[model samples]
Target: MLTAADAELARRETRVTAFGLVLDPAALRDRLAARLPEAPRAVRVDYLRYKPGTSVLAGLVLDTGAGPVRAYAKAFTPEGAPEKLAKHRGLAARAAAGAGGGDVSADWHSVVDEPAHLVVGTARADRRLPGVGQLAERPGRATGPDASVRTLRYKPERRWVGVLGHERPARLLKAHPPARAAAALAGHRALAAAGLPVPAAERVHPQRCRGLLSLAWVHGTALDAAPADERVLAEVGALLARVHAVAPALAAGREAAPARPGLDAAAAAVGVLLPGLAAEARAVARTAAARLADRPRTVVHGDFSADQVMVAADGVWLTDLDQVRIDDPLADLGGYLAAEIADGRVPPGTDPYDALAPLLAGYRPCGARLDRRALAAHTAAALLRRTAEPFRHRHPDWPVRAATLLTAARDLLEQP
Candidate 1:
């Protein structure tokens, strides 16, 4: 017979082993009650974002024995949790005001200046309507292990997304939190002015301590799962070229690139967590760093990958503009190629360079030149960095995969 203590342990283990999460429904209810006392009993808890043993951000629905009310609950061990929560509350208040078409003088800045606050199904006081139409909250795409990076969609074409991870590794962010959101908003506007298909940033709350960005949803399917062909790939290449073309204007009056991947630093970062592979990872980083010297720099999409670009019937559009910055253009190309290669877009033992030929061919005519050495170096760094990411902690085979990528990075660095 299983003891009570054993049963609780098994239940927690199930949560971690199965869903990559350990959530306490009772604790979640208590938090919700504190925030929304008048709301009824919490009948259900949904995990929107879960990083096992680290953090879990969830969506809660309460039934006041009358109707349902929705709210968010976050549980984590990162530093400054109290401050982050306070910031989020401010963001939520601003979002509420925006949705209600209230003045935003205190909390927000307008990017496009259009009324993007009213989501499709939200209750708006329209002179033309008879009764309030109930709006449904839909789940948006999940980016990674950190639940905070996911989206909470109030409508199909509009979303509430923000950076909720506090104290993320320094390698991920060089600028402070508020600056990161402001830069991203700047990127969105610049891309839109340049005639790119990115979504319009509607309302942004970028205070000195914390910030959040809510984008008007651009309807589309993610290219990673889309049925992409040469035509589709060509469109993607052309758009990237267009992005690079506008880098200079975006970076104007702003700080230079936030961080550069130095070989020594990259190796040190990787080795700090995985001591066994420190020597080899550092050696590869050093070689790649030397080869990357004197490469041309431009505004690169810091986190470009197939999943980041979306494909709609009209055209291709990109999302997650948070990492935009001035850097080697090849970093964008290399990051995309690295993701594709890891996802098996390139067959094992086949050169990713060869596989990327058509895309590069499409890009060349758009006035961007391809540098093999720079691309390889950036690609190696991208792969090495992936080994230390939060997502790696959840993957059962991450050890084998990380080692394989490191070896591959060494080989890529060996290329002339």
Candidate 2:
């Protein structure tokens, strides 16, 4: 069980990142006060994204003398700080001149370029994030008309996803760091060529879309949000079966993410956050590593979850296809089920098991053989890996939530 001391340890560890100064709200308020039009009362910042040693971005509500202004502050490597700030200054100038900037309307885009914070890091991820918005709104592109680019998720210097339209998005945009964008494009093409139910990539003018992957809008409610309907579940099961059978041959040029390292990393993070569960977390990962290796390997969604599934009348479509690579096929199943159970992913008042039964029922007849023991181990590992999520996602009671997830993993492992 996690005591008060254990929770304190977890909170303290969050402040010890490589970019410690950039992640500190107090430091941010001081550093940016001079840059703003008027420095006044206070600043409230929440970590939007943090990738150790690479980048960190914060969303802030600054209490200036004028009023409150919401802005994003992206980290920069010391070597690139001058260049990055210059670029933003240019962006501010353009906006001030009324030319506008990014995907935000020309009228209000200036808010994004001011009161920036600087830090030593790898590169500027925030640079092209707004550019994808520009590409989405431009005419004669893969982006259909009238859709707006709303950021769905962001991990600085890593990857970002934007939905160009809401709920049933008119277009989808996945942006990567300049170095990794090409591989992402290749991965999408490979899946599309294999006749998977992947969304079609839109063809945009090549001039300004360097690190952006734009897709024709996919129309469907997310699977986790939709009712646990039988038809969609069966379709998902069959789709996974096909992908597992065909993925190996198709994976020669694609990425490979083995289960062992990911599990080991998860265990280490849990050890750091909840010392009481360190031994148990290690056991979960070790057992999962051994069991996962015994099974035949195939391409797996490295981060599969209910959110990645889109249920439409025609079929089940997979979103966030960037991590599709070779690994234990059961990793996909374990991940999906782990999120469903731990995240309370099913609709309100619905038991996750009620959803799980029909999903397994649909899965069994689809030519895929599952090892229940391995699935259990992987699910436990998945839960342990996600122990930090509540904290990362800004839950007010993160310590309790993280400890409860750790306990769930232990229970899953201890079960007969």
Candidate 3:
């Protein structure tokens, strides 16, 4: 637990890195006044959570005389790396030198960088990580579980699927949950309507300031561990094709995927966090992003892999809709194949592309075409992104594993 003073310090540091200024209640109030003068009361900023390497000063709620605004403010060290921040400071200096300089409202982008905010804020705002016991007694929403919240997965996001005595049916509690649970709820309905097989979303709840999404639990083992063979892999590909076929229809009113983190952002994220790999990460990101530039776009599972698909007697069920987006479909394929390769599911020294054959065979039958360049580019990006996580989580083999992935990414990018 972070002390109030510690939280405040983190907030200040985050603001400095995010924007070239430190913001407090008074500063925030003045800025709000400038942006929307109707609210004149002092701003109350509450810090929710901060996981330094991953995000800084996340989950903030701004309460003003007008209303309460929830903002997920995250400043990654790389984004705030001394060099990048210096440029922003230089911009601030130039703006300040002008008559209307230093005013937060003067630069609309700084005060309201919707892209950055939405990318970090929406994610951080709604979801929280808490223990299983804490959840059963959580304020506002508490259910005395018949059994422990049997956790399913605990990386990138926390999840559990189990029974609540009164609910009778099995239920799922997804944590570090989504900021856009409502959006996801809508998405689930749309996908179901489109004839895709997805587990239903029961409800969205906030437990003790933490976010939770209750889903109608579907009992199945992940295909990665289930009785999966080539046919199963092909079926997975076909299912993905089905998703693509109806993605445009399901994506109504939803935002297209945000821009890829790209080389600069990736470099910055890794550089800021790892420091030792700053230069190396920058060079890698630059090469990878350049290679990945401009591919055809389609609906994609933003975080697809074998593990996300569940197999049961009924059929194959797709899970984790939090990252559904409009991007290159090959991104989904690349992510899946990359995971297979990295996890050692693919035999060592075997060409990863060879492993993609059965999937492509299934996919192409559904009228989708594959671009070799796009596939290679996105696959490399996926591998490179994997390298950043170990460092953030402080895994013991992060150095060796990161090096291996970095090399693989570089090799992919340089391939003819």
Candidate 4:
């Protein structure tokens, strides 16, 4: 007994609601195709939920038979004046064709200004694998002997299109507040000026409604696959030292604040969904915070980890500059070391104390021996942050890993 308008509204709501439900790429394709009758011939899709706070954007690749074409799609609630539907359609058509270079869908303008081009690029990058389309059709083939290119996706919602080939290092920044994007850009420039290897800034697009400020891509491979050799680690360590050496600038024109609480909050949020280790995890965070309260302040990568570090033919490139801020250097060191330890590549007892020597030698600090107490404190705090990562929509094993990190933190707290 529903009117046609009512039915259409229901359909739109259903698609939006799917964001909360478990994602099924195949099912998503069907829904998308139903909406667009002029569907491309062959299709490949990949979804990734990179981090909490960014929205999810879906990447779809269509084999137009001419060649591969990519597009990104996201949904949003209508806002602003109730203009005529035709007006909205006209605006969408212009924006889609103007910004998307005919690769984007016109339907997207009805929801938002334009689909996030960054997200679209990311999706295209993931689909470049030789058998990705085949893998999509045969789900079981995902683990087969195929050289797959990983897609980088973040949330509250982000998606990209284009082949992000393995060797192409990319940088992704969720610039919710315009200031954050500006700051990230400043940081990247600073690294480049310092003679450190970092990606050049490309573009900044504002997603007003979604509160995203997208930046240009940084090309490189995350150091996630394996621990670097001693020499590589030493070089990386030196790079970190040099990065820290750049005189602290209020790059974002923002004052520094105590980061301990932020780290605690991240952990507490994680603990909420991971009730089993909630108490212990919170305790570890608090202990780390208290211990690092007196650490010397410097520019530290707030969320540094193996994923943040990329190794490329050019050299090591650090991505994710949005979290760049003045803090204890140990925060970066600790978080990275904790990741290494958690990955089981570095034994807990293996002393990395001397590892800094080569790095320091390379950096040639103005003063020998940077503050160790503060470094250790920041390290502890970094571990706490890692232990408290949000688990919603994350893999089932994530919480287990968080719990394991909590255990490691507790052990570190007991040391000396």
Candidate 5:
């Protein structure tokens, strides 16, 4: 059924089915034979990232003589198959000289399964993400500087963010495709220029290395990782108000109204990955479409959540500014509310919104008046859009969890 999309995207036949083969360990052991020192003792991988009819990126841990070597592989459409063979080979050679440590090294490889009609590129590091090695060299601590790079997140060909050192990192290095380099720089620079409690941006580029964005680490425990103090909530609320006060030009794009809710792609993704819940996901989308109240747009931190902030004596620091855009202020409020409810910290059998009391109390005084309807609708929209995350994150019982999130979204939209 997925192959039905080939003609539409100009992808090869079985483009979707072929990518699935790469996830089969028995098949991978043979396809990647040249790279493995011997028959792989075992293969560990998860269907971590998938874009139907396009690509799939998965984390891999292979048993080898040296122990489990961590790596990644991306299986993609073969429209430009012939040309990428040489490109991948060249990049693989270049990466062999790049510095790396830990489970995965910088070495790379590629293999094409002609029968599958797909190009599979595998690497210990993200070749598409530029300048990580250079950013890793920056200080990892204020004084002693442990400086070991630890992956915070990875979504191949899209993003790879790593924190330097441990416990308390001194820096965060991000690598996205170069085409998005300018937008990434603008978001942070604008926030910093506005005197927000966000990290200062340091550009990474020189003749020898590729361009990347490096951020001074925000010191303090992240709110999501620990209990969030009321004071921390207040500080975060005040900081967000300041961000909304910033001129719209500070961030370049505007978010679409919820009536045209951006969950269309996410809903479609549900159809492919969790077909049983696809209809409910679509119904939730429709309910959200009619529930949003019109409001003036402001600068919004497009992806605000408890995980996006770190509290310290000096200030509450914000990170992850890539999604900065002009939109309904309630959009951010929704992001926060959705995360709070989804986090499961709220006592069982109690209304989830009770968790937002401290946050909203802190918000109303410093920020615009709350629009209860808009907030409810926006939160539902956020939950709906994120319903696919459980599957994408490789949870073993993802379907049940994903269904719970959908139920929450539907309930939120039902609010009168």
Candidate 6:
């Protein structure tokens, strides 16, 4: 439940509709005047709405006599007040306080939670911008869950522009939890340091809230957009091989697997909304679990697929490291193969053995070969898990697509 004050804050944050009906900036100013006893002169107010992948955010830039203050706001509507917004503000303040200018690192202290209000810290000028210029020149747009509420391209002078948030009711997906998002960001940075072909990540902004982690934009075409050429495939294979080389280590004495969520738990949550398909999905998951139990475990890209990889002039730069986890390496291979087949990149009747060759040619197996049985099981598991995703349910062809993939896995399992 939102307090009266918070509710009012959200209402003030609603963006103007696309029909040219603008929000009354004066009225909002009046409200703020009453809230803040200082009654600073509001010079200008612009409601900049941004959709990052799947999350919709409105940034309220209040130019006042005191200074320019920006607030990144997300509205919950009937979902009530978002639990993470205040925390995000607090974290942002902390990050800004401690972060020095220049260099890419996790700027974790930018959030601030005061007794009277919450504030997300802003980066002051004097910071060195590493990849901002390259990103700005690339002109990339993100949709789906990968969207950002506000994306900033930092320059040496701390200059930035907030792109993609003008319309009202923008839809954006909540980012993965902060810890996992950070880990994933850290993983990408680590890979880049090791000279692996991965997106370079400099923590532009730390976790201000539980779900908000801002990262430097990587410029490249998604793997799905790249031609299925030998070069592209080889790049992906090499990138994954290098990532696998960095063995998993315990962070602070707790073994950190890749930041991927539990497949069983995700499936169970999906089952609640899709009761009719629960039994079959659960059974498929069980079979996958049982089979995977016997396979060798290794570091893997938990959500490997064509869409997750990006092709660039330099090489394949993998993004979305948030899903990296320690699991049967076969699971990653199976997932990518299953996605390729379903997307019609590979012929329907193509034998898994033949498909494995090119994939492995680039991947360069680190150790023991994953048997067909194990691959089949892992592929089935990946399909079941993906089908249970919330976004898949929204797609009209999801059920049919899921069923088809399941059948493919079942056929493979029954053959040998």
Candidate 1 — what's its lDDT?
A: 0.52
The residue-by-residue lDDT of candidate 1 on 1-416, one tens digit each, is 22343234335533222122223444434433443435347534442344444444444444555344333344444342445445444434444222211110111211110111110111111101101110111112111232222112221111233232334411111112343456667777877877788877732223313333456555578888987587888888888888888847666654343334555665665564456889998788777767766777777667899898889888889887767777778888878877876776764345756867767766778998777777888788777666544222324344566677777777777777
lDDT of 3 at 349: 32
Give the per-residue lDDT of model 6 (tens digit) for 136-165: 222132222322234333211223333333
Q: Which stretches of candidate 3 lie over 4 Å from their true place?
A: 1-134, 138-148, 153-169, 176-178, 204-210, 256-262, 273-276, 347-352
Q: After superposition, how far is residue 340 of candidate 1 from its true place, in Å?
A: 1.3
What stretches of model 4 exceed 4 Å from their correct place? 1-20, 23-152, 157-179, 202-227, 250-255, 307-315, 342-344, 347-376, 388-393
Runs of candidate 1 with Cα error greater than 4 angstroms are 1-179, 204-210, 253-266, 390-393
Residues 1-416, candidate 4, lDDT per residue (tens digit)?
Answer: 22342233234443233343223434444454544435445455433332223233444455654344454444322331123223435433444221111222222322322221121221212222212222223212222233222333423223232222245433332323333445655666766666667666533223322222333464556777645555665567677776677677644453357766776776666554455677876777677677767667676666677777777777777876666777666667767776667667566544445534444454444442555545555555655666644233333355566666676667767766
Please say which candidate is ahead in lDDT: 5 or 6: 5
Order of models, best lDDT first: 5, 2, 3, 1, 4, 6
CA lDDT scores, all candidates in order: 0.52, 0.61, 0.55, 0.49, 0.65, 0.47
Top-TM-score candidate index: 5
lDDT of 2 by residue, 286-314 (tens): 77677667567776656778788888778
Model 4 scores worst on lDDT over the 10 consecutive residues at 116-125
Q: Is candidate 2 or candidate 3 better by lDDT?
A: 2
Provide backbone clash counts, one per model. 0, 2, 2, 33, 0, 32
Candidate 1 local lDDT, residue 357: 72
TM-scores for all candidates: the values are 0.60, 0.74, 0.63, 0.60, 0.81, 0.54
**TM-score pick, better of 1 and 5:** 5
Cα lDDT for residue 6, model 1? 24
**What's the CA error at residue 412 for candidate 3, in Å?**
0.5
lDDT, model 3, position 276: 72
Candidate 5 lDDT by residue in tens digits, 288-359: 766664677888888899889887668788889987877888888888877766676652223435656777
Backbone clash pairs for candidate 5 read: none
